[model samples]
Target: MFKKLLLVVFIAAISCTKNDGFQPNGDVLSIIPLEKCENGFAGEYPCNDYDLLDYISLEEIGGIGTKGNDCWGWTDPLDNKEYALMGTNKGITFIDITNPTEVVILGTLATRTVNSSWRDVKVHNTVAYVVSEAADHGMQIFNLEKLRNVTNPPVVFESDYDYTGFGSAHNIVINKTKDYVYPVGTTRSGTYKGGPLFINIEDPANPIDEGGFINYSHDAQVVTYNGPDTEHQGKEILIGSNEVEVVIVDITDKSNPIKLSAISYSNVEYTHQGWFTEDFKYFILGDELDELRKGLNTRTIVFDFTDLDNPVHHFDYSGSSAAVDHNGYVKGNTYYLANYTAGVRMLDISNIENKTITEVGYFDTYPDNDMAAFNGVWNVYPYFPSGNIIVSDINSGFFVIRKSGS
Candidate 1:
């Protein structure tokens, strides 16, 4: 009878291998081939011009129990290999997506603290800087180059450096151009009131805590000013998506960050995230709760940052679906938006001056419904040089998509 019970326990453990929660490592399933979008679907996923190259389910990325949050990409300059860094409820999973169809699960860096639904990652100088909303989870910095020489598969990795300067950050933004890492949404009562905590990551391993902004910024994009604003030319500017208002700061001087302007819209729900156009002439803003609160479609507001001191509201571009827009980034004229239920939608902003932006392509990961609820993609990284777009779905997992021909 004891031997039979032991046999049953062994079988149960095998069955539970796919279960969620910390699983130490992940399983690498068969690679999915490229499926072109036909009619209204790409394989089983609903898509348009965008074709699904491959998909790594949350279970395969981590475990069946874990859900994905944010995602970012890193391209190794040595071999020109692209990797997808996907955030899970527990930790961040790295995958070699150089060959999207036949990708491999490189490894995972478990969260510093307890698992939470919110985790973010950004890469700089081949090092991935991760953050999570989990309690006491400050920042986990892992050497991404270590991925190149992995002898065994799906190895459980450790952080090279852990900084406790501030705990629990919502997002980590790296201004590669300026070589500074900004951790936003920190402790609300901290020095900057949850704004941007500037940490100079010039030395990727050892980061220096410079200072922070005081406007309570939830999300921001910092860039070296080369916009139409001649007054602030060549300055390091930060466009922050503060809750109730959009605040622009001149972070050139770490000791004294200057607030250039703070602007607000009419139906402001929650200023979630946004990105600037390549020309720096316009800034696209996404209000997280505007859809549910105002009963509106996915509305993306555009701001004309021509003048640093006074950013004027350009116009609002309403998407066909009512899915809440979580995060978006502008790559040239294309705006890659992670519309919650609508999946990853690509908008063309080539004609922003005339206020004409159109949705070029989209892949709806959540086929249930395009409601205002947050159930689909949390973030998208479209800046990969290979033209491969990687999206992080809250329910599904990681999606590697690209233009039909590209």
Candidate 2:
């Protein structure tokens, strides 16, 4: 009887080991290629593995500051060279990514105030605009063209313009068409309290505070959509990822913005960030804490934004891995998702109207199974024309990748 009991316990232990989700031998901090699995997809394309193209070690660039959160890629209109502007606790690090194989570290501009964990960057014309949530850390402006003249590697420089008014900001987005900058999450007290701070950056180096709305916006994407509402035609609409709901606001008049409506869906656990479809019909939202709290993969809530006042939840697509969803962007029919440890996932949303998303390819930067943590890919930029995808990893650093065959 004792031998039988021991045998049963051993078998149970083996079963548990087989079902374990942790990848102990995996490269938790290294990029690896993704293998093709027919769990759902019909066709098998050449999906390249998440190869570690290059790792920008903190020692090589600069030690991590208070926080290194977001990044933006700037392209020189004259030379047509692409540069990466990374947001750190200290400030922003500019790198020339013209050569994916060899990422050149241009330099970094320290924070205007004390360093914080969160910082965001955006580019307009030829200038880069940065914002951080550090105390007294207002917005800083730098001319990106100056980077072209850097003869030595890692050339350090100071900010040319410091736009003061808001002390701290979580994220900043620029509206090139209107020359306006939207700074979301301004206060450091807590979530759902910081409103979006709007500033006009028509004069690259010099920014003017136009005004902002206190709608408690955490992150947002602004665009002038021609679909749906006729009354809002050609008007700039701000889609904010509020704490509990997606707030749609008409910010055409920055001084006095009107709240269009607020939309929410089931299993909503922190309405963090979202992006709109190219046709302005659907809005993809990312729940920051759903994976940890809900015991499921990161849930991406898709909503029909056809009616500005009445947004409907169309469908929810959850990845196979358990990685949490962070920031995502839509280009044409593809939804580029920064799936924490899962790396960057490219979803084919050609049939978004039917609420169908096919995972065509994925670059698993974090070899470990997706878990609820901020130690993996934080953000991805896939609009780099050259098919080279750039992922900013929290633990492993930055990676530059191209499509498999490309």
Candidate 3:
């Protein structure tokens, strides 16, 4: 009773406290492709099988007091050049990381308003869409193809277009198959009450805000359904990470989105974010307050999403650290997790059907302690074609890592 009441009353006060950079240069922190993790330590950062390719500090990117938030990757189809699109407290930063040995800072775009601790970025086709918790900070769209035109090192870039459909969003998800961007966690007192604002981004620069879902969503993932569910196949589905429960909605029809189902677990602290397996059979979720409130190690929840109308809890996997688990993503048979203090953990989900999962490797960016505090890696991107992973730390800034001796 006390835990629930305290969470209801005290969480609102604590969640509003936001405090909040980028640096690029070989001078800050740089390790080449040879820092092997033989003795479980890559340079000074702890690791297992991943080596530190490059590191960019907050000071080098003009983010002295700001912290890193979220990140996404973009590969130029015209030339196959990979770039890292990262978010900070103040703005969004872009870096050309094709050459891991000599990572170049392409540029950065300032926030639409004041600096806020929460900022998120996503990409579709050739454009990047950015959103944040800053007041009146509308969505900032940038044409990513311009990166090839940047001859200088790191310059300040501006948004090609800004969509003012909503303000102060926490995150954004893109359904690439349909060219729609859903901006969620907007103002609580607004029309949709913090749900996802359905905006068509087919044109990239000019966005059309049609409508939104009628509930709150902290983060979400939308995809064209090709799962085992035959009835809902070929439709656009949205799995939302609500504060308490996971809500599945059929968003194929933008004007009339139908809620398929909602599910909650045994100990629901705060459903921060989750990701579907590559096969779209299971959903792995991370609750932000589970470690802090329950006094447990990193606990990851998995759910079988075979039937969209009735999802069931699969199993729970406990990590090897007391650090809090935040954002997580699955690529192929591996799960890339961003742990606040434990850094990024790589879990092998090849045998997920048997309810078995294992942590294959880990790279600890914060070696001090593995508490549930929020001072370590904020996000990780593993979709680069060259296998170079992007790690954005809240304190350490940006990093590019790859498999040792690969």
lDDT of 2 by residue, 308-358 (tens): 988889999978778889999998888999887777888889998887888
Ranking the candidates on TM-score from highest down gives 3, 1, 2
Clashes of 2: 6
Error of 1 at 138 (Å): 0.8
CA lDDT of each prediction against the hidden true structure: 0.86, 0.74, 0.86
Give one digit per residue, the lDDT tens place, for model 3 in 1-406.
0011111111222222121001121112223453557699977789999987777887776556978889899878776677998788878889998666567888999999999989999999999999999999989999898898999868899999998878889999988788899999999899999999999887876788889999899999998999998999999999999999999999989999999999999889999899999778899999999999998889999999999999999999999878999999999999999998999999999999999999999988887889989989999999876678999999888888887755
Candidate 2 lDDT score relative to the true structure: 0.74
Q: Which residue pairs clash in candidate 3?
A: 21-63, 21-66, 22-61, 22-63, 23-60, 23-61
Candidate 2: misplaced stretches above 4 Å? 1-52, 64-67, 188-193
Q: What lDDT is obtained when candidate 3 is compared to the true structure?
A: 0.86
Q: Estimate each model's TM-score.
A: 0.91, 0.85, 0.91
Tell me how far the alpha carbon of residue 64 in candidate 1 is from the true structure, in angstroms, after superposition.
3.1
Candidate 1 segments whose C-alpha is farther than 4 A from its true place:
1-33
Query: How far out, in Å, is residue 140 in model 2?
Result: 0.8
Better of 2 and 3 by lDDT: 3
